[model samples]
Target: MSSAEAAVPQAQWWHSFYGGLQKMGRSLQLPVAVLPAAGILNRLGQPDVFGKDGLGWNNVAKVFAAAGGALLDSSLGLPMLFCIGVAIGMAKKADGSTALAAVVGFLVYYNVLRAFPEACKAPTVLVGNQCIDYASLKAAAATYQNPGVLGGILIGLMSAWLWVRFHRTKLVDWLGFFNGRRLVPMITALVGMLFACLSVWVWPPIGDGMTSFGQWLSDLGSWGSGIFGVANRALLLVGMHQLLNTFLWFQFGEFTKADGSIVHGDIPRFLAGDPTAGQFTSGFFPIMMFALPAAALAIAHSAKPHRRKEIYGLMTSVALTSFVTGVTEPIEYSFAYVVPALFAVHAVLTGVSMAVTWALGVHAGFTFSAGLIDYVINWGLATKPWLIMPIGLCFAVVYYAMFRFIIIKFNLKTPGREDEDEVEDVTKA
Candidate 1:
């Protein structure tokens, strides 16, 4: 094939892959948006808070914790939530049928996995009577590591695909009731069973490998965290950061609570009271709450004297948004395209912040972004909440100095620095 012909197929593949990632990223937000509620409720019920003796709200704390635990607990929590969210989000149309099918499919898949070992023969047998070892089977089943959110995501995507393909299917006269969207759940139930059976053999190795990989990431410590930080920001440039987050925040690690229920991923583990749960997430406090906001100030300061007023309001709004809500998109997009090098510098600084906080043994968790709201709400759960302020202050200085120097030295066209016509266009917008 000619070079152009070869490139056509490659380009198509790239677009297809990119499109899928974008869809998954958007779909993931549905489930993620509920996390803050879970975090707040869980924190409210902890012993150090309203649950304590002097607080005179011990029973109230239990109620709040139970309500929150219903969302974060292993049995019917995040994994199941993801299934419903992803299914509806990814389907051609967000329908109740899709969400219902996702839940049914996940339950069937999960129960089948649990029930399979008992139904099958055990590896060991008694030589005397050649009896099947039911005890071993039960033990084996107990030892099975639930795939957790990863499994939920897999089944959710499958259900969505099924919905897209069969939501309009016709059926024979006698089977009319199961036609179109209604058929989706029935078909998913069978598919879920099949996947469960297949998972008996297919999932063990994959699960083990994933567990080992999680361990490896934990062992990498600051280096793994820094890499994640850099990638998180860089990927945000293309709106793919959610894909990265869904894995790290929802499926990265495994922790078993005192009650024997296991929680997976950094966020869930943290909510479950795992002491080491926040390493992958804590670093963002400095970057989002301080550094990027300071960068916003630098951009506003470097603008032409006459143009500063025009851009100051925009900069200030984004800065406060970053500080209070940890939403940095408004600030990032301003310079992401105008001066790509600054974005690269911003990404690197983010990585440094991650590494520093991680090395300093500072641990914090957030259900959403590293905003002041989450910082305060989750303060009791953090190892060194006060340390974040000091770290954030340092990052503020660095971000301000670096951004100002770069803007001035390179004469970069950030916000108000555009040519007169361009500035007029921006200002008018």
Candidate 2:
């Protein structure tokens, strides 16, 4: 056989699926890394940061809030970030023009939707079924917020892919005016318009579906949140869970504020000072704040005594990352890559944690991940905040015991416990 044919082995469908996920995870790094700074800014600016006593810095708080919130909450900010981040991440050359083209394409996509709402609406999914929340849906058409981050991601990837394909194409001399990078943005715009028009025709049913799903999840109450929590962790394995967050956190509800004003999305409503913001997010506190760190400790403890120090160093850094920022992927993927079964258990535990917390009627909001920073930031506005610490401690013990037993029993190679070559490699890191 030829060298290429001999080296390449056919794989099952699951191999392709996993390969795609790994690629997605790599592409997400840039966008994800930028979140911490914005999150910190938002935490600083949130009300009650200075407490009821620090009345003097109230204006300062507002200034900080505006400064940070602008990056996330502003119209251009998030879409632009996604476009550029995804473009750079996916491009082989990582060209600046690729990123610029992506941004322009994304804007063109939304601009079309905004300019012609009626033309965009598909026939009602059930003909007579309410396609979407009428007033809010209409508002979204004007504001063009429903497409959201998922929309930005779709456009970003498309723009980048188009740039890569046609960027170096050579045109005849007569048509040379529209050659190279100059041709990219224009073609990207046309593609964006096509997708936007398609969205106009296609999104009604999808929007209706999103609305129905949100309503169903809300109706299921804590149980629904628990299932959502499980799905969240499991999907995170493939780096797709953020898509669900877009619906639940941002596009789910017509949340009303204390002033009798209404807004869509949990985050925007919470920032508007709504108290119901935490139902979907609060469940993560126990898992991130206590359970994951505890699990990390267990993994370290299970390592051979000679390797304990090295294991401790790696786990300690990742565990700290998880606890402080709710960035669990580092610690999670470390083990999940080696012991897939253990990851399943982690996902299940996350569901139970969310259910238990929601059942107890605790609520807390976070702009970032469900890390300690967000938990503390929203605590003053949270429901049953005091119960979180005690409950979290209980979870800590449970995760520790469970992870230790499973890893030891299975001899799972979780970081420090890897075989000879893996051990040396992990220690170096």
Candidate 3:
């Protein structure tokens, strides 16, 4: 192929990768939406909350706990949800068959992993009266190592792709019953089995590498957190933060609970009550809950006086969204391209927030975004939760002062400062 042609495919590959990640993020919302409710219920059901001995509604609290706990239950919880959601969301069209295929594929895939040692004839160890495949047992015991959420995602993606590719395939006259969508599950089962067999040999080393990488990151401490915060804000410009989240939120870090069950990723570990769980997440509280909103206020104030009224509503809405829901895109995108330097500064400020929070030993986590709702809902689960407030207030002042200075000094076009005609057009629109 010519050089241009080669470049075309390379560019296409990146586009596909980015597009796929976006789809995966959207698809995951199906399952992720349940997390806030689950987290709240789980917390409220704890002995310290509604379940306290002095509380008359201990039984009700237990019920609430069980209800939420069932959804969060590691075994058949998020993994299965991801499978069904991805199968439905990633398909060319949402189809029940695709979901069914994902579930079937996931089951076969998980069992194959679970049975790998015996299937491969790996040596077993005598454990009391039973001969246990200790290696396999060990892998099984570590919940993170088990083909958990990642495996579900893999199977779901494969099943969805297969359904899209073969769901309409025609069969021989006698085999008409297996034609069309019915063929998807059959193919997925075979493919899932092969995938599982391969993963037995392949995934262990990959898992080890990931584990090693997590350890390296952990060793970096606040520096690592600072780097993550910078990268996260930078990646937001491209809407590719989901790729980082797939690893950091779902697969990074390992924590063992008092019951000896292992949980991986910041969100899971934090919900499971791991003391060290929030290093990856706590910093965003200041950035999302306080800093960005303050920055929004600065942008509003910096607008031309004549246009201030027109832009105030927009700014107020986005600022409230950031503070309450931790969605900062509206505010960030307002000036991200208009004044790239300001965005860069914002990214650095985010990194500083992350580093400071980590260094202070402040542990807080969220089911959704780092917003007021999450901060309050997860307060009981956080270590030194009160500290986040003062930290956020400080960040608010810094963000307001810095953003106001930058916008005015550069005459930046942030929201209300648009050209006269453009502002008129926006108003008309």
Q: Please tell me which model should have the higher TM-score, number 1 or number 2.
A: 1
* lDDT tens digits, residue span 296-333, model 3: 89988988898788678889999999999887889999
Give lDDT tens digits, candidate 2, residues 295-330. Answer: 899999999888899889989998999999888888
Models, CA RMSD each: 4.3, 5.8, 3.9
TM-score of each: 0.90, 0.81, 0.88
- What's the lDDT of the predicted structure labeled candidate 1? 0.84
The number of the candidate with the highest TM-score is 1
Q: What's the CA error at residue 425 for candidate 2, in Å?
A: 7.6
Off by over 4 Å in 3: 1-14, 53-59, 117-145, 258-260, 424-429
Model 1, position 296, has a per-residue lDDT of 95
